[model samples]
Target: MAGIAIDGISMVYTLPGGGEVHALNDVSIDVDQGEIVSILGPSGCGKTTLLNIIAGFLSPTAGEVRMGGTRVEGPGAERGMVFQQGALFEWLTVARNVAFGPRMAGSPVAEATEKVERLLTTVGLQGFGDKPVYQLSGGMQQRVALARCLANDPDVILMDEPLGALDALTREKMQNLVLKLWKDTGKTILLITHSVEEALFLGERLIVMAPRPGRIEREFRLPFPEQALSQPAREVKAGPDFVATREEVLSMIWNMEEEIMGQAEADQG
Candidate 1:
């Protein structure tokens, strides 16, 4: 029930030589409770940086971030993160990995065990719970990662290219799964992705960023995802609106890339 507020955030990374690299500049975004937002951009556009700032993994050099109006100073259980790769403990079984969060939070053994079962079922990994993480397929591993995040019952989910590593078929499958989870749980989700198709399919709102002092350059309120909810994802994606939106976003990003290259050339000249 908590929304996120990012106000004028800027991040500057100081190199060993004292040179400063401004990764983000005055980037601001708001994610309402239970809303799903996706971010897209070319490489080095600070998409991940903004997600990190929201997750409280990195403090902004300027401005502040708040979750449900409380300032975000550092990592907390209210926000759960899913990375590009399933970073599950290779040594632990899928069930254990899912149970880890609850146990760590001091939930009773019975309670955590029941929660793990429910989460595993939620992620479609019910029977695979006892399997070692190393044995599961790449897609299944990601499922475990999702289950683990959900087990914590976090108010917000931060996914950094969560489907980027999967094969095309698997990625598409996971896209629907993400939508299902978002609708079923009603938790706020902020996704960072490189695929315009994926973003269009999953995001109720889409944000596009530009690099070299990365910032949000464009945003769209998309109807495709909501449409996909009632229709098949493939049908929705193939619709005229979806295709048109994808092209517009692609052109926008392509222009941003050209601008970045132009700036670099001028700097060298």
Candidate 2:
């Protein structure tokens, strides 16, 4: 069954002078339960806008989103968001942060504590529970964010560039962790990423969006994610098919960017 359905979604913003900017145009996608999908697009392609609409943080100007046959009206406990920067409360310790969702939901004290502990361990922060979020490194903090999202036991997780801020080595390690968590939890995940390679590695199904008014440009079902699950990520990325696919995606996005730039120049001229 489809976990989330986005039908004919279009978003328009009214400018100060009453001009309108169309951010997304008739974008539609149905993500299956437990699927890992990644979105990639240029700067103005409305990737984040689409994600926010699905998360119920923003209402689209046209169309609607549904989860399990129910129209999404607003934020609910079943959908969790992990932002580019870890949005944890700085004053809260790692344990409290991870426990926030369950605690807010009125879970029994003992149950919430046990869940937090297990999640911390699952995210590799078992011993750092008592530390303030400020004390951790960038990568570790993101791990906490992932655990906090999982603590809610949400059916769908929306990640907006969750690994965008990490250093290269740390980002790679986090990528592996994300795949492991996806495999273990069987949760549906929709991740928005700027990096072509990251999108290729993390997405079982990869979506490329078009510019101007963002819409689905191309979709690819790749074997790399499954391959990376059992083999070293570096090796999987180095395989011939992976290299070929990466080049194809890169060229597609690069051409879109060039066209956008040329259009902007012409408008200015």
Candidate 3:
């Protein structure tokens, strides 16, 4: 089971000046195998901090993260990450970038080559194997990043604003591609994004977080992602149910932001 369990997680950063910043407060979440979950929150809400904790890149001051019933103490092959910048080696060819993981793991040449070819085709980059990553468009670079992450065959994929850099059309296309990949691979995915619409579209479960000592504000089980599997994403987004949910979530975040600003003003005054 590739399910994730985050229990009683909290993070406190000790500032150099003698104070402490409470980044997260007893945040706990359970993600079942093959679940696609999206997290949203205002800036400083610790969304990325939570993700980094789950990725084992940072340890919480209290509590632990478990995957497949084992505690996650550090990064492992069972997890892969896709970043906002499509963090690929610009000097490497697309195929080489995708194959980097398997090669590092000492996969046989023939097997790794086969995997790379299949993944390129999976990501719609089949014929562009030899092209340097720098030569690709932003969207194409992201596709390569996706393929590279898939190459590792991780049970879980962590994405932090993976589509945040793209234009509208490209972002929508990438959103659909994400759905397709999730459907085809059945990998557990936890994505952090600022876009409420994207969160609703890609997540079977959507989580909203609040800032001051960050914690889960609300958890919603949404139908849009399942609906999107068969329908055009635009059509799904246009539906009354989807639109209503998006507005509600937007308002929720907006209110949180307002509260934060008010608090800041009070402190200054």
Q: How far is candidate 1 from the true structure (C-alpha RMSD, Å)?
A: 1.2
Model 2, residue 78: C-alpha shift (Å) = 0.5
Give Cα-based local distance difference scores for all models: 0.91, 0.94, 0.95
Best candidate (score: lDDT): 3
Off by over 4 Å in 2: none
Q: Which candidate number would show the highest TM-score if scored against the true structure?
A: 3
Question: Per-residue alpha-carbon lDDT of model 1 for 164-200, expressed as tens digits?
Answer: 9999999999999999999999999999999999988
lDDT-better candidate, 1 vs 2: 2
Q: In candidate 2, how many Å is residue 71 off?
A: 0.5
The residue ranges of model 1 lying beyond 4 angstroms of the native Cα positions read none
Write one digit per residue (lDDT tens) for candidate 2, span 50-111: 99999999999999999999999999889999998849889999999999999998999899
Judge candidate 3 against the unseen true structure and give its global Cα lDDT, from 0 to 1.
Answer: 0.95
Better of 2 and 3 by lDDT: 3
Error of 2 at 168 (Å): 0.8
Q: What TM-scores do the predictions have?
A: 0.97, 0.98, 0.99
Question: Between prediction 2 and prediction 3, which has the larger TM-score?
Answer: 3
